[model samples]
Target: MSDATQNDERSQGVSRRGFVAGTGAVLGAAAIGGLGLPAQASAAEAATAASIDNGARVPVLIIGTGYGGSVTALRLAQAGVDVHMVEMGMAWDTPGSDGKIFAHTTKPDGRSFWLRTKTKQPLSNFLGFPIDQDIPKYTGILDAEEFSGITVYQGRGVGGGSLVNGGMAVTPKRENFSSVLPSVDVDEMYNTYYPRANAGLGVTNVDQRWWESANCYQYARVGRKHAERSGFPFVFVPNVYDWEYMKAEEAGTVPKSAVAGEILYGNNYGKKSLQKTYIAQAKATGKVTISTLHKVTSVSPAASGGGYTVAIDQINTSGDTVATKTVTADRVFFAAGSVGTTKLLVRLKATGALPNLSSEVGKGWGENGNVMCGRANHMWDATGKVQSSIPTAGIDNWAAGGAFAEVAPLPTGIETYASFYLSITKNPHRAEFTYNAATGKVDLNWQTAWKQDSINMAKSIFDKINKKEGTIYRTDLFGTYKIWGDHLTYHPLGGVVLNKATDNYGRLNGYQGLYVMDGSLIPGNATVNPFVTITALAERNIDKIITADLGR
Candidate 1:
């Protein structure tokens, strides 16, 4: 190992994973407390659906049940405020005919996509053949929403993006913090909110010793080898999955999740999604209530009352609205992920419902500088067939290359001698969301060519490695001749940015009880996974909102 690698490992205490011998008691207690909460929260949300009454009044209402939504709900509920969250997706509590809550990544079913007859796999092709297939149109976990320029993959469930991600809980470097959130207090964030968010999200690094010899991680090893050979820093990234449970899966001592190719769509076990963390704790408080399959259509100041009137639609699994209802709330929070929140706000303003809203409400949207590609390795570099679905490492070349590339897994159940990657670059292009009065919908003005900036930034790292290893780009995974998967983004950020769209603390500029809490508050990108920053910023904003706005 190089000196940089040795220093990185030593600083992280790589020999021991999250569960060290001295921390056995703490880890055991946390497992028993958290591992079973997702199922319970799912069951509770399902039960709450039947009791969701129309025309009911609430003290506080949140638009989405994503990371920011969940964090906001929990903190507000703890501060003696009653919160009701509206989610446009299913509860995901019940098992399918296969006795699993989520579908297998390699065998996608109706449960994989949201209202799409055809499955839009990120890697759309294999061996020069298109791999998408027809599936039943249903309300599913992952939403591959198509726009004019890009397809943004967002999680559509009570737990939001936590339901369908790689569980990579990455925080941006402190030196780059100013660019991530220039208006926020860096000292308070680093000293207080980031740590709280990480603890709440259950972030932990993989055991490096176990990784060195594990068959499932041979792909990561190969990726690290190539990165180090090119003089790049191979850093271990943290995740929200339970490393102990993954070790059990590797030993065949438990049912598999991460080790059995269970990501993208959903992870059946081991992953500590928001359902097992903030959402679970929020439900336990008894002051927080979530209504699944409930989509908010409009928000306006109530004519007869001193609060906001919200229009909601209860939808079925086939994406049909079964009923529409109106509710009043003293306070409203837009916690929907970036796209959902921006779309709703833009439409409401355009239709004159919330016309007083600031002009910046639907501006400053970005795709988090996302791009993907694959490299065909030499015959001697055979990545293992039993690859783990969860990524645990990345190549940090952001300073020199403006790219932080994740050594993502192929997990195709066969060795194809290919190394796949998803690079989060420092691309400086941002798009805007505008109300398309012609189509009666919101449209993002993101051009496909904007991705070229991302492609160049990513090449700074991959090009050097490919040159050193004499490898060629894999053109079969994305399309017949396409080497860059630049059509989509797994991380969607910004819209109602901090200080511009909202007050410095997320309070809407033109409205008093309306708050913007979520990835939409972030301005474009966080230079990393983005969720940890999203959660931490929510933590900071809600603290101030409760004390100042709610008088708590």
Candidate 2:
């Protein structure tokens, strides 16, 4: 595979030295904390501040602080509605004993888990050896929440998924969007909400000039080289990480994050997560307040017809409940992600907390058909010695098959000529979450074999590339040499399906003041990365709700 055969973007780029030297002097001399956030007090101070106002009766209440929750809270607050959000996670703005907001992926500790004594790395192995370690249990960022047939990874903090993700902000293709979410108004999403969300989230594409020469993107270039050889189109995926800060890190100027292999944990700097974007803006409105470490256990119609009575538990970092309180809300929005919201709704319906919840409450759920596999490239490919953990490109073969695979980064900080990919495919194996009354738990009826369709869809792209590049699957990753990770998902979407479980705009079918506003409202799966869609949908729904329902 030669550079001559690739596109002009790949063939014509700055030299490696130019990438570093171009920004080295300029960024190195600039003030640190270029985002204007105070240096040491951000995480801890933010957490402490959000913990104020333990209980309140507000006009609007949001559960969880991810995209949906943050977006809804911000919009309602902007409309002069007093908003209170209850989050089960800790506030991530506080630094730990290490004086760091989060731990590094390569050197995970107490700051990497939710409350378990052991750390669960998404890439649990390297070269077929288990790489996880046992650490002291504490409240942490990334959560590998386990269930029967799957381990769903979620971020635990004020920013939700934004606290710990690859920061790949992607919207589903326009033509495919209709199938993924049939009830959504197409034009409103693409023309209004998507652009609005993108601008608010600070999503941007990598500069072609810098990507060509930067050592961090060498791994992406390798993936692009292989995809082109296999007749696949490599599309540039936008991200929330700041390009300037990334360049500064590569130039040895600002503190390193994405370029330093900090992902799936938390970025200490430069990533415009929800806490830095929507939630921060929401707080600025002064009408919105948040209570951290408070989980909404149940919500029932208030004796007075105008509101809901909510049950909450306030817990400490060690998962010890210190207080249980009740709060009333005029309107309640379930913004906990698909799993969390689904679990709450299912248990609420099954246990008689809210007996009138629709039967469709927990009917539709899927893993977004997520699967991971890697290819062992030839030494000549030379995926650089220093690789950026942030991915910038993907193999888009959705027309030929039902798969969109991102060219992921290894970021081992050493040359291995390895090609990595995390794929999202169309596997129609949706599961249902049934509440177990005896155990008071929510059970998902999903089987391991259910993922074979996803595996087959993903293999369609990799098989062609492997044959074209004369490479083979790496036996070390996921498990044995040729096996793929078929039982986990970082993108768990759907549960309370749209239009069926709720109205077109997320109003719960059976309740007047209740709504489902998170990824749970999405039916089954999204064709691409889901955060962008979640943000746009929240914006659209809240726009209608504010105009028609809530009065200032």
Candidate 3:
């Protein structure tokens, strides 16, 4: 398809203006035009028309424009609160000369950095390439030698991890959530937020009829057979791709899109990332002003008011850092994911920028014990192409008192290509986060028991799979044996957990105008994709803050 034709096709059903209006109205309470106000505002102006007498200072300033940050911003804005969003990545939708979107990792090798340089196709940041040799590489937050034994993938642009993560919108089982957070009501939370999240992100189930195709059906059949032989049942997985787009592809109106296949490389055709969803709407609010490429360096009590002064370093497109600006805000929400927020808070606490930070800022870190494993049938062709779309089924072994494992249909769906990957939940492993006195870098050191309880759970589930129709083989490991290797999760959580240092609702216990609302608030492993949960919890926390007018 010609570039112009493809662009037109993508924009066919939705206009830029319509998309923004719908998003803002649905997600936030602020009139679309109210988000552009400065940090300080009169109480009368900040309150929603319905609650004008509440007379509160705008309750939030969200940092990072990822899932949690985006949702929080939209909700607060919708409530008629003035919100300012700061991010370190440039906006997508607008493309460079090569028609590439900068969502993924940039390589040092020019050949791999630009999509035009390698595939001659339009690239979105969601589909990342290896860092080229010429680009400077940092050791980053995670320790490479301790986990996975490979370099980890992290997105540095606008949408954060959402840009490059598998667009699977799987919710954790209720038991899993209760196991880690016994106090929260999972059912009520799910009911309140799941639908909201789905609507905002345009989530839908892949059509079962579409799965009947050779590519989707064969592997699904294999999964069913294995489940029957092993005393397990296959359950369909919910995803976040546009079903209309899928239908168009099936009708031959669109090319074979990212649906029914792996989405990590980036789904040019399916899956909705935040940059296209919430961020776009936040901009339309006209009340919300986003400054991309502005990295927050420090935050402290404001000199002239009862709020905070945020020090930021603004970098230009050429990677030149210049001009430090101190922006003041009445309230601040830290949604910089688990790692980002934890790192910043740790530095602030150690350096005395925010000395009242609780001791729990860097504890209770867990990796959800993620271990990606898969098995192939003996008669199956091992080299056939695997399906690239998200997996549609999962084994509810966890509910039955076993391990967590989901079977995804491979991209090609041929018999030989048929492979089912499993994310085995492990016994909780505890990691500690500490700061280097000299380098100012945070350090994470984790240790776990060799015969952890979660491993035993995985083995029981694997035995059932082995008893079924397929010959089992595991590609990813936990520690050493197929049972021991620890898979690093895209969903890293805890560390600066809620209640430990902050209050039950994420407000810093003794501090004023400080709050955390991201993955860091999740106390431990959730045993599934955590984006939905993170966003939901953030929404809940923001509601409490606004209701109480805590910071104002």
User: Which candidate's TM-score is highest?
Assistant: 1
Question: Which portions of model 3 show Cα errors greater than 4 Å?
Answer: 1-60, 96-152, 214-217, 259-262, 316-320, 381-386, 409-420, 424-426, 448-456, 470-487, 550-552
Query: What shift in Å separates residue 375 of candidate 1 from its native position after superposition?
Result: 0.4
Model 3 residue 223 distance off true place after TM-score fit, in angstroms:
2.9
Question: Against the true structure, what is each candidate's TM-score?
Answer: 0.92, 0.90, 0.75
Candidate 3 total steric clashes: 41
lDDT of 2 by residue, 210-303 (tens): 9998988888988888899889999998999888999999999988888878887788887889998999999999988888878889899887
lDDT of 1 by residue, 81-186 (tens): 9999999987777776667888877667677888887779898876555667667777878999999999999999989999998989998899999998999999
Q: Rank by TM-score, descending?
A: 1, 2, 3
Ranking by lDDT: 1, 2, 3
Worst 10 residues of 3 by lDDT: 119-128
- How big is the positional error of residue 152 in model 1, measured in Å on the Cα after superposition? 0.3
| Residue 3 lDDT in candidate 2 | 39
Q: How many residue pairs clash in each candidate?
A: 0, 5, 41
Q: How does each model score on lDDT? A: 0.86, 0.81, 0.57
Question: lDDT tens string, model 3, 511-535?
Answer: 7878887888876576677777787
Which segments of candidate 1 are over 4 A away from where they belong? 1-51
